[model samples]
Every structure is written in structure tokens, then in C-alpha cells.
Target: MDTLLSAPILFFMLGSIIALAGARIPFPEGFDKALAAYLLVAIGLKGGVALTTADTATVLPLLLTAGLISLLMPLLGFALLRSAVGLDRVNAAAVAAHYGSVSLVTFVTATKVLESSGVPFGGHMVAALAIMEGPAIITGLLLAGATGVTAVAAGAGGGTMSMPIDDGRDEGRDEERGGSLREAVREAAFNGSVLLLAGSLLVGLVIGKPGLEKLSGLFVAPWDGALSLFLLGMGYLATSRLREAASLSARLIAFGLVMPLLGAVIGLAAASALGLGLGDAVLMVTLCASASYIAVPAALRHALPTADPGLSLPLCLGISFPFNILVGIPLYVAMSRALLG
Candidate 1:
């Protein structure tokens, strides 16, 4: 409820509704890329700095649990989509990848909810975040039996990659060769968002408290504002294909909505088993509950060419992202509180 009222979510919905109503909100060129980098770096830096004082040994279980949850999530999703929903393996795997991966924006939004509630979460969660992105992607690709296809760009926050990766051949050659699993793996591993996030985390670890404090003026105070603007841009991009969501079969839409809940339940189980505190538990639940609109989609484009973007994109961005923001975050928080407090 209160989560729905926050500025970031409001801006997201405002952008969405505005776009839905057939209006345009212009942003400066490359604005989204800048915001995405800043957000990921800030998240990494904060996590890294926090890791300085915290006992690293304890963080291991949390990271391991988060990774296992991420890997397991998509397998469950694929089975449900195939058995109950009747999607083919490729599409099911594609959509499953989304369910398995975390949405940085959604995590950020959940953090805001915790902040408003005065709850504190561990920065080691960022280390968890770093490991969480790639495994689900690889799992999805493997389950789909994707050898690989053409490369596509997904920025850190902009949904575009930072640099173009040439696959040792021109586009025509790439199409003919049918890029290998290695290519897909590379995309998942070095994705702009993932690379920046993981890289920044290392940088943060190396720099520690002193470094974070020196840069606090930039990354700390103004994070929410940057996030709001990026979400607004994402709203425009998401709604660009908004009709895809509207066009989805009822079952698919239902899958989009339901998968997040199922994911969250498993997340809660993991948290309890690991004895995570309230804040980390909430984030872990949110992480599982979040479907990736970021790295998964890009990797899927290269990995599963036959997989329909229409279904996957709408489910991830349109149905799941908003549901998590408006309804899921607070619900998961309550679930955590019930379990932990």
C-alpha cells in the first residue's frame, strides 16, 4: 500500500499511464544509460563498503542461498509454463529466465519501501546480486537448447550494452555460423549491467568505507531522483510494445502474475532456513519475486531466437514489474515480518 505511494513507483506508473494514453514524455538522449550505470555502481559501492565491516564468512550462506534460489526459480517456472500453461520449451525457458533473474529497479524500489519502514538490509546482498544474474540466464539457455543466435544489446539501465561485441564475424557470417553457447554465455556474463555491477562491487570492495564516503555526495543522496527518471524512460520503452501485453492470452497473463508469488514463497523458505533477518529476508523474497526486464531479455534475444519477445517482454515488464512494485513488495515485506519478527 505505502509502497504503491512512493515517488519511484508513482513516476513509473505516471510514465506508463501517460504512454498508455498516447502521450509522450521526452528525456535527454542517453539519459537512461547514464542513470542505469549510476544506479548499479551506487548499489555495488554501497554493498562493497558495507562488506568492509560485516563478517564475510556469514555472507557466504546468504550468497549461496540467493544463487541456488535464482537457478532453481526458472526450472520451476519452465515446468509450470509447459505443463499447465502449454508454452513450448523455448518460450517457456525464455520466460523462465526472466522469473529467475533479479530486476535491479525492483530491488531498488523495495529498498525504498524498507527505508520508509526504517528497516536496514545488508550490503552483502549486492554480492548476492552480483552472482544472481548470470546463472539463471545460462540455465534458461541450456533448458531451451539454444546454441546461440545473433547478439543484441541491453544497456545497464537503458537496456543497451555499453560496447558492441563483435562475434569475430560480420552479421552475415554470424547468422550463417549460428553463434555458439559460448557467445550466449559471454553475453550473460559480460552484460553491461552485470559487468558494471560486478565491476563496481569489486571496486567498492577495494576502496571500502573511505572511498564510499568520498563519493557519497554523488551516489548517496540523489539515488531516488535518478531512479524515478530512469523508470519514466523505461515506462516509455515498455509501453512501446504495451499492446503485446494486452494481446497475451489470459493464461499467459496469469502466468506472469502468478510466477512472482510462487517465487517469493520459495524465497521466504530459503530466508527462514538460512535464518536471515527481516530486511534481508524481504529483499530475498523481492529478488525471487522480481522478473528480469534487464539482462535476461537481451541474452534471450541471442540465445533463443525462436522465443517470442511479444510474450516474454510483456510478461516481464508489463505484468510482473508493476505487480511487484505496487502489490508484491509490501506483501513480501509483511510475509518476512510474519516469519522473522
Candidate 2:
């Protein structure tokens, strides 16, 4: 409970409350993007510095395990959505992609919790994070294709299939050309967020501790404050989109709450099987449990155009994101301690 009441969380709640009450908070333009970039760069640098001392043998296996988890999570999520929640193919695949990916903000928050608790984790977890980002996107795309939901329109009509005609002759020409998939894959792999994180990680690895020490004043000192502000923005975004969430069915809402728990269970199993310690286990659980609000949304906008952003965004950003931060993080930590100890 004390952990839940921490400053970052409180700021997030305050922002949500203010937004829900229809109060206007004047945030400077591009401030949110700036905060995100700063946080990612800081985290990548810290991870790289930590990697300098990490054991390669352990890191390799953990990275592979995290990647495998990322690939499989969407498959599980898609199946559950289709069989249990009864979401259509496009919506199911789109939502599945989100669950399969990790939220950088949530991962950062978990790191802070671990740090405050005096828990030690590997720097290579960042590699795991980067690796986990793309596979689920691919998997979701494949699922959509297999179900013939690709090229659907991006509206609230729920997976109605339609293709735009260029001069009435290009109808089905775009589909035949297979251009959209290529674009989505490129976006998923080379998206600004992924590139910055991966590049920063590499830079950190090359520079090691000396580089980190030199840049610590900028990246390290102001991390928590930046995160609080970013999360405050997140709070406002989530509540503003809360109306969209009402369009989702009861079953889909239940899936939003349930998927994180399931992911955590899968994470615990993986961590235990790999003999991870307390902090790493918690972080692993967090990676598995946290759904992407940033990367996947952008990719899906291009990839699954017909997959309603209205549905997936609200479920992920508004519902799952908050649940994981407020309730899921502590729960995963407790589970990690009990198991890892």
C-alpha cells in the first residue's frame, strides 16, 4: 500500500482525477515525447553500464527465454480473446500484439521498486526488453493474416473489411503488392523508440562505467522526476480515453484485467525454470505482464488499420496499464520474493 502511494503513482492518480474532472492542465508542446526519450536513454545507459560486469552465459539464456515468452504471449492472448472474449480476428490480433510487448514505463517503475527494495538485477534485462518488443508484433500480424483480417478498416465498426480504391482500378492491387506488411515490419523494427533504446544500449555498452559517470548528472539524477511527469501525462491520456473503453464489451474488459495475471504466472514459471534471483524474477514478471501502450499502438496503426484503436488503446492504456502499475507490480514482487527466496 505504501508503495502504491509513492510520488510517481500519486502524480499519475492526480493527473487522472484532474482529467476526469475536465480540468485543463497546460503541458508544453512535445513535453511528453521529450520525457519518453529521456527515460529510455537513461535506462539504456544504466543497463549498458551494468552489462559491463554481467556474466555472458546467464545473459544469453535469459535473453532467449524472454524472446520466447514474447513470441508466445500474443498467441495465447489471441486464442483467449477469440475463444473466451469472442473478439473478431482483427481486434483479437491487435490486442494480442499489445499484451505480447513490454511497456518501458512499467518496466522502469518496476526497476525503481526493485532498487528501493535493495534488490539486484542484471543489466542485460534491457536486451531482453528490446528483444521482446518486435516478435509479438510479428506474431499478431501473422495471426491476423491467418484469420484473413488484414487490410481491414480502422474504425469502430469492429473488423469490417474494406480496401480503398485508387482511381477504381487499384482495388485489391495494394493487397496483391504486399506493401503494407513490409511497411509495418519496418516500422516495428526501426521505430524511433526501439532505435533510440537499442542505440543507447550499444553506446552505453561501449562507454561502460566511465561514460555513465560522465552523463549521470543528466540521465541518472533526474530520472524519477521525469518519470513522474511522463506518468502524469499518461494519467491524463488514459482518462481522456476512458470514454472509448466503454465501447468495449464486458468480456474484453475482463480480459484486460486477466491477461496481466496470466502473463505474470508465465513469467514466474520462466524465472523459476531459469533460476533467476528475486530482482530479476520480479523484472521478468514485469516484462511479461506489462502491455505496450507506445510502440505497439504506432505499429498497429499502420499494420492493422482496421483494428480499432478505440478498443485496443483504451483497454491497454486505460485499463491494463493502470491495473499493472497500481496492483500488478506489488503482487508480482511478492510472488517473486516468495518463489525466488
Candidate 3:
């Protein structure tokens, strides 16, 4: 509890408050987008620097685990939503993929907290993070494909089959292709987050620690300051979106909050089985526990247009996101230490 109320969390809360209150401040919305780009770059670069700290042997196993989690968890999440929630196939799968995937902001904050508390994490966790984003996006599309196939089978000679994705600000667009699994794979692999993360990873690998250390004085030096400013913008964005829409259902809220815990526990077990240290375990749990608000939502909007974004995004960014960043992280760290140590 004392750990949860530490300075970093308080800084985050302060940023959230500023974001919610900054509506009248005369900055252009485009400025916020630029801030987001900076945040992403900073995060990617930092993750790269961290990766440079890893030995070769530790890197492979953690990277492999990250990839497997990215592949497996989304499929499991989709199955659970379909069987239990009765969401249509595409919607269930899309939401499942988002929940299964990673959140960059959450990952950044977790790393900071771990470092501040003097917990040593593996550098390859960033590799794990970079690897984690694409799989869930692929799985969501696969789930959508199954839905499309089922619809085709059931409605032959009857009606058109449409699978819609919903995001709160606007209606989603379809992937603009049909009847080719290869195209789906291409779309998933080439998504924006994958491009950025992969680019950053390659840059980091090429630059190595010496190069990163030179740039770190600028990019890494005021990271907390940058994150606070960025998260404040996020808070404003979140609150404005919330004000524009109605509140979410209790079930959806529960789903958002609880599902991450399940993912974290699963990740803890996986890390322990793989014999990861405290830092790696915490990062693994954090990645599993964090839900994607950016990449998955964008993919879902294109691939599943009819689904409700109101249900998905709010539950994810609004409810679960805040809970995980503020509360779930500290709890997960403590739990990982207790179990893995």
C-alpha cells in the first residue's frame, strides 16, 4: 500500500488531474498527437537501451516467451469472450486481442517503479514487449476470419455478412481486402505499433549502450517529466471522451479490471516455469496485465466495423487502464517477488 502511494504514482495522478482539467487551455489537438509520437519514440528508445543490457542467453528465452504469450493469450481471451460473454465472433476476438496485448505507457511506468525500488529487470523484457504487440493483432484478425467464414457458411444464398469494429470517436473501417489469409497476415505484421517498436529495437541494437548513453542525456534524462506531460494529455483525452459518451456497464468494467489480473497471474506462472528473475517476472506480468489501447483498437476499427468501440475502448482505456497503472502494478510486483523470489 505504501508502495502504491509512492511519488511516481502520485505524479501520474497529478498528470491525470491536469489532463482532465486542461480542456480550456488553448493548445491545439495536434499538439497532443505530437506529444504521443514523442512519448512512443522515447519509450521505444528507452526499451532499446534496456535491451542492450541483456546477455545473449537470457535474451532468447524471454523473447520466445513474449512471442508465445502474444500468440496464445489473445486466442484464449477471444475464446473466453465468445463462450462466456456472447459477443459476436469478431467483436469478441478483437476485444480479446486488445486485452491480451501490451500497453506501452503501462510498461514504461512499471519499469520506472521497478528501477526506483531498486529491482533489477532483464533488458530483453523490451524485446518481449516489442514482440508481444503483433501476435494479438494477428489473433484478433484470425478470430474475425472465423466469424466471416461462419457467416459465409450460414448465409450462403441469403444475405451479406458484415463484421464491424467500434471505436468511441468514430466508426471503424474494414481492412479493405477479402478471401486471403495472406493479406490478413500482412496487415497484422505491418501494423503501426509493430513498425515503430521494431524500428526502435533495430535502432537500439545498432546503436548499442554507448550510443544510447550519449542520447540518453536528452531522451532518458527527463523521462519522468516527459511521461507526466504525456499522461496528462492522455488524461484529458480520456476524460473528454468519457464526457462525450455514456458510462460503461458493470460487467464490462469488471471484465476490464479483472481480466488483467488473470493475465498477470498466468504470466507469473509462465515466468516462474521459465526460471525468470524478479525483474523479468514483473515485466512479463505487467505486459500480460496491460491492455492495448492503441494498436489493437486501430486494427479492430479496420477489421470489425460493426462492433461497439464504446464497449471496448472505454472499458479498456478508461476502467482497466487506470486501475492497472495505479493499482495493479504495485500489487503485481509484490506478488511476483513473493512467488518468483
Candidate 4:
């Protein structure tokens, strides 16, 4: 509870409340994105600076574990969504991919809390963040394509996927495939947020402690205050968009809440096996618990055309993201303390 009373989190709550009351968001256009970019750069720099002293030997195993966890989540989410949640396979795979991916803001918030509490964790976790994005995305696309079909209806949000018509000519198909490959490359490589995170991390790694000395005022000191404003905006965005998904089924709504806890459990258990300390274990759980609104949605917009952002975004942003921000992180930290201690 004390954790929730922090200035940044209080700002998030205030944003959600104001949004619920239907107040107009005061932040200018692109401000929210700028905040996000600021956060990624700050965290990436810190991660890089801390990583200067990290044991190279342990980094590889931790990174490999992150990848393995990312791979498992979408598969698990797909199975649950299909059998229990009753979503069609196309939507199921897309949402599953989202579950597999990490949310940068959520991870950043968790780290802030850990830092405040004086908990110790490895800097390699940020590298783990960068490493975890791609596999789940590819896995989701394959699962959708396994049906060998996609059919878009006449109107927006009309329906889910349909079988693709078989064509004799392979020429145009090759061109289309080539274009999709290029699109995939952009999503993986050129996403502005992820690129900046990686680039900033590399800069930190190169600059090391000397860089930290020069930049602490800009990046480190103001982090929480900046995050407060950022989450304030995010709270509004998440709430305002809830109306778009008001028609969602109760089971799907439940899944949005339940999936994160399920994921946190898996990630925490995995971290335990890998001998992670309490703080990193909590973060690992937080990473698995988070659903990617940015990267997966971008890829799904292209890869699974018929997959509804109306559905996926609400589930992720409206439900899971807030849940992680307000309740889930605290719960994971407590769980880590109990288990790890």
C-alpha cells in the first residue's frame, strides 16, 4: 500500500480518475510518446551503466531463459485462449503473441519500485528486455498462418479470419511475401522506441561510469517525476479506449486480468530455477506478466490483418497494463520476498 502512495503512481491514479470523470487530457499531441521515449532512454542508459560490472558468464544463461520464457508464453496463451477463452484462432494467436512480449513501461515502473526499496538486480535484465521481443511475434504469425487463410469482411470489425483463396500464379505471391518480410524487419528493427532503448543502452555501455557521472541530473534525477506525467497520460488513454471494447465478452475480460497473474507465476517459477535473486525475480515475473501493446500490436496490424485492435488493445492496455501498474507489481514483489527469502 505504501508503494502505491508514491508520487508517480498517485499521478497514474489521478489520471485514471480524471479520465473516468470524462475530463479532457491536458497533455499535447505526441507528448505521451515523448514521455515514453524519454523513459526508454533513461532506463536503457541506467541498465547499460550498471551492466558494466555484470559478470559476462551469467548474462548468457539469463538471456537464454528470457527467450525461452517468451517462446512459451504465446503458446500457452494460444492454448488457453482457444480452449477456455473461446476466441477464434486468429485472434487467439495475436493476443497470445502480445502476452509473450514485454511492456517497457511496466518493467520500468517495477525497476523504479525496486530501486526505491533498495533491492539489487542485474543490469542484464534490460538486455533481457531487448532480447525478448522477437520470438513471440514470429511464433504468433506462424500459428495464424498454419490455418493458411485470412479473410477481411466489408466493414470495420466485421468478423474474424477466413480461408485464403488458392492461386495458381506464384509470382505476385512472392512479391507480397517479400514485402511482408520487409515489414517484419521494420517492426523488429526500426521501431523508434525499441531502437532508442537499444541505442541508448549501447551508448551507456560505451560511456560506462564516466557517462553516468555527467548525465545523472538529466536522466536519473527526474525519472520518477517524468514517469508520473507519462503514466498520467497513459491512464487517460487506457480508460478512454475502454469504450471501444465495451462489447467484449466477460470471459475475455476475465482473461485480461487472469493471464497476467498466470504469466507472473510462470516467470517467477522459472526465475527461481535459474537462481535469480528477489529483485530480478520480481522483475522477471513482471516482464512475463506484461503484455506488449506497442510491438505486438504493430506486427499484428500487418501480420494478422483481420485481428481486431479493438479487442487486443483493450485487453492489453485497458485491463492488463493498469492491473500490472497498480496491483500486479506489488503482488509480484511480495511473492518474491516470501518465496526468495
Candidate 5:
């Protein structure tokens, strides 16, 4: 309970309440972005340092497993959204992409919980994070193509059209379609977050523990404070968009809540099979269960423009993000302890 009431979570709540009450808190422009960059780099460097001492035999298998989970998660999400929830191809794929990708904030929060509880985890998990970032996006794009929803140039009116994949209007849009696919892949693999996180991990790996110790004053000491500020911004952004989410169908909202639970179950089974320790298992489950709000959204907006951000963004940022933080983390931790015992 004390863990639940930590400063970061409280700041998040405070931000949400203030936003809900229509109070204006002036955060400087680009402050959020800078904070995000700092957190990613710090996490990466920490993970890289940890990776130096991690048993390669164990870490290698976990990376492969995490990558497999990342690849398959979107397929499951897409199938469920299409068959059960009755979402059309484009929206379903878009939502599935978000589900397949991991949320950095959720992972950071879970790590905090693990640390508070005195459970140790491997730094290779950061590598797992970087690895898991891209596969689902590619999967979403492939699913979109399979459904025949190709990206075309905007109409002369500067308005966007939500056209089906098989629509006959795609006669001469080959160049545009190819460009979008390339762009999506680029965004998914090399976005600011992924690059910084991956780069920091490599830096940590090369520098090892001595480097981390020397730099702890900058990266380690202020981590919690940075996280609290970031989540405060997140809380404001998440709740401010609730009005848009209100338009989503009950079925979609249900999927947002339910998918995380399903993912957690799969993550637990996989981690247990791989013989992960309790703390690692909890982090794995949390990663599997959380959905991306930051990186994937930007990719989708550019790559799959016809896919409504209104539908996918709210479900991820508003519903799943909060649910995972408040409820899912504790549940996964309890499950991990029970299973590992």
C-alpha cells in the first residue's frame, strides 16, 4: 500500500485531478520531451551496467522469449479485436499495434515496485525492452496491408479519408504506399525513445559498473524525482483526453482492460517456463501487459493516418495505462511471489 502511495503515483494523481478540475498548470513547452529523454537514457545506462554482470546463458534465452512475445502479441490482439469486438481492419490493427508494444512508463513503475520490495532483476530486461519495441508495429503494418488498407496521398481538400484496403482508389498511389511503409518501419525502429534507450544500454554495457558508479550522481540519484514529474505530465495528458475516449465503444474499452490481464497470464506462463526469478517474472508480466502510449502513437499517426487516434490513443493512454499502474502491478507482483514460492 505504501508502494502504491509513492510520490510518483501521487503526483500522477494530482496532475489528473488538476486537469479534471480545469486548473491550468503551466509546464514549459518541451519539458515533457526532455524529461522522457532523460528517463530513457538513465534506464538504458542502468540496464547496460547491469548487463555487464548478467549471465549471458540466462539473459540470451529471456531476450529471445521477450522478442517472441512482442512479435506474437499483436497478432492475438488483432484477432480478438476483429473477431470478438467487431472492429474493422484498420482500427483493429492500429489498436493491436499499441497492445503489442510495451509502455516505458509502466515498465519504469514496475521496476520501482520491484526495487522497493528488494527484489533484484537483470539489466538485460532493458535490452528486452528495446527489442520488443518494433515487432508489433511491423505486424500492425502487415495486418493493414493484408486487409488492403494502403496509405494514399491526401485529397486536394487537405482532408483525410478512411478508405478500406481493397478500395479501388489506390490505382496510382504505389510511390506513396511504399514511402509510408518505409517511414513506419523507420519510426518504429529508430524513434527518439528507442534510439536513446538502445544507445544508453550500449553505453552502459561498454562502461560497466565503474562507469555507472561514477555517473550515479547524475543518472541514479534523481531518477525518482524525474519519474514523478514525468508521470505528473502523463496524468494530465491521460485525463485531459478522456472526453475523446468517451466516444469509444464499450467493447473496445472492455478489450483495453481485458487484454492486459490476458497478456499478464501469457507473460507469467512464459517467464515461469523460462525459469525466471520472482522479480524478473513480475517485470516480464508487466511488460507484456502494458500498452504503448508514446512511441507507437507517433508511428501510427504518421504511418497509418486513417486509423483513428481517437479510438486507439484513449484506450491505451487513458484506460490500460492507469489500470496497469494502479491494479495490474500489485496483482502481477502477488502472482509472481506465489508462483516463485
Candidate 6:
């Protein structure tokens, strides 16, 4: 309970409350975008710097594990969502990819808490971020394609599924009628958030630590301040949007809350098998446990356009992300120690 009421969650709550009260506090949308960009750059640069400090030998095995987690966890998430919820394959797969992927902010917050607590973890986990981000995204596209087929099969006779009519159609008409699912898949993959994050990471890595050191003040110094302001705006936005969500679907909420715990267990067990130390184990578990808001939501907008954002966003950012950061991290830490000891 003490963990639940910790400073981080309290700060988040304060943001939520002020937003719910309908205070017309002006936060420029451009400022939010700038803040997001700064955060991605700062975190990516920090990750790259930390990677530069890691031993290549140790980094390789951990990198392999991170890559494996990125590849496999999405399938696990997809199965769970398919069995637990009635979500169609595309939406389930999209949401599954998200659950398996890491949330950069949540990971950053966990790192801050661990540092404050004087817990030790490897710098190599930063590389894990780079490893995991792309695979889940690619998997999500495949899942969407699979779901589109399922949709077509299910709606075959419902009048929604259209067949290419063959009333002596011309070659141009035939070509026009035969649209492929690859196009939808491509659209989802090349989204704004994925491109921004991938681009920022590349820039941060190519620029390296020296380039980042020159601008640490704006990116590093005021990071917490920017986060606070961003959260404040987000809290207001969530509250305003979620007023109608009190009666929202409970099944989805439960899924959002529980999946992180499951993911943490899988990640922690993998860490133990690989002989990861306490700090790395905690972070690995945290990464598995965390879900993406920025990347997945954007992908889902393109992929699962019919999926309820009001239901999805608040469940992810408002409920699950905060729950994991505030309470789940400390709990996972304690549990990892007990189990792995």
C-alpha cells in the first residue's frame, strides 16, 4: 500500500484530479510534442551512452535474450487475448504486440526509482529497448493481416465482404478490384510514432554520447520538469475523456491490469535462467510488464481503427502504466529477490 501511494503515483494522481476538475490550464499541444521529442532523444541518448559502457561479451547474450523476448512475447500475448477476450484477431494482435513491447517512459521511471533506491542494474538493458521496439511492431502488422483474413472469412456472407464481380470486367477494373492486405500492413508499420522513435534512436546512436553531452541541460536537466508538465496535461486529457469510461468494459480493464503481472513473471523467469543479476532481472521483468502508449496506440489507430481508444488508452496509460510504475515495480523487485535468491 505504501508503494501504491508513493510519490510518483501521487504526482500522477494530482495530474488526474486537476484534469477532472475541469481547470482550463493551457498547455500548448506543440509543447507536448516537443516534450515527447525531448524525452525520446534524452532517453535514447542515455541508452546509447550506457551501451557504450557495457562489456561486449556480456552485452551479446543479454541482447539475444531481449531479442527473443521481443519476438516471442507477442505470440504469447496474442494467445492470451484471443482466449480471454472476444477481440478479433487484428485488434487482439495489435493490443498483444503492445503488451509485449516496452513503454519507454515506464522504463525510465523504473530506472529513476531504482537509482533512488540504490539498486544496481546493467546498462545493457538500454540495448534491450532498441532490440524490442521493432519486432513487436512488425509482429503487429502480421497479426493485422491475419485478422483481416479472419474478418473476411467471418463476414463472407454478411454482405460486408465484397467479391470482385466478373461481368466481363476489363484488365484495369480487375487490377482495381484486387486490393491486397499488404497495403494495410504497410500503412500500419510506417506510422508516425514508430518512425519518430526509430529515427530518434538512430540519431542518438549516430551522434553518440559526445553529441548528447553538449545538450544535456535541456534534455537531461529539465527532464523531470517536462515529464511533470506532460503528465499534468495527460491527466487532464484522460479525465476529460474517461468520464464516460466509468461504465466501460470491465473485461478489458482486467486484462490490462493482469497481463503485466504475467509478462513480468515470464521476463523474470527468463532473466533467472540466463543468470541475470537482481537489477537486470527487475528491469527485464519491468520491460516485459510495461505496455506501449505511443507506439502501439498509433499503430492501432491505423490497424484497429474500430478499436475503442477511450477504452484502450485509459486502460493502458491511465490504469496499467501507472499501476506498474508505482506499485508493480517495487513488488516485482521484492518478488524477484525472493524467487531468485
Winning model by lDDT = 5
Best by TM-score: 5
Clashing pairs in 2: 153-306
lDDT (10s digit) by residue, model 5, range 152-178: 435421225555555565654555556
lDDT of each: 0.81, 0.86, 0.72, 0.83, 0.87, 0.68
lDDT of 6 at 43: 70
TM-score to true structure, per model: 0.88, 0.92, 0.83, 0.93, 0.94, 0.79
Give the residue spans of candidate 2 off by over 4 A. 150-178
Residue-level lDDT tens digits of model 3 in 156-223: 22324453434442212222334233444565568776677677767877787888888887778877
- RMSD (Cα, Å) for all candidates, in order, is 6.4, 3.5, 6.3, 2.5, 2.3, 5.3
Per-residue lDDT of 40-145 in model 1, one digit per residue for the tens?
9988888888888777577988898888888888899999999989997767888998899999988888878888889998888888877888788878877765
State which candidate, 2 or 6, has the greater lDDT. Answer: 2
Residue 263, candidate 6: C-alpha displacement in angstroms: 0.6
Q: Write the per-residue lDDT of candidate 2 for residues 246-339, one digit (tens) a residue.
A: 8888999999999999999999999999988888899999999999987888887766777877878899887898888889999999999888
TM-score, cand. 5 vs. native: 0.94
State the local distance difference test value for candidate 5.
0.87
Off by over 4 Å in 3: 1-8, 18-28, 149-184, 240-246
Candidate number with the higher lDDT (5 or 6): 5
In TM-score terms, candidate 2 sits at 0.92
Residue-by-residue lDDT tens digits, candidate 6, 203-254: 6667778977887887777876776666666655556555644655677778
- What total of clashing residue pairs does each candidate reach? 6, 1, 8, 1, 2, 0
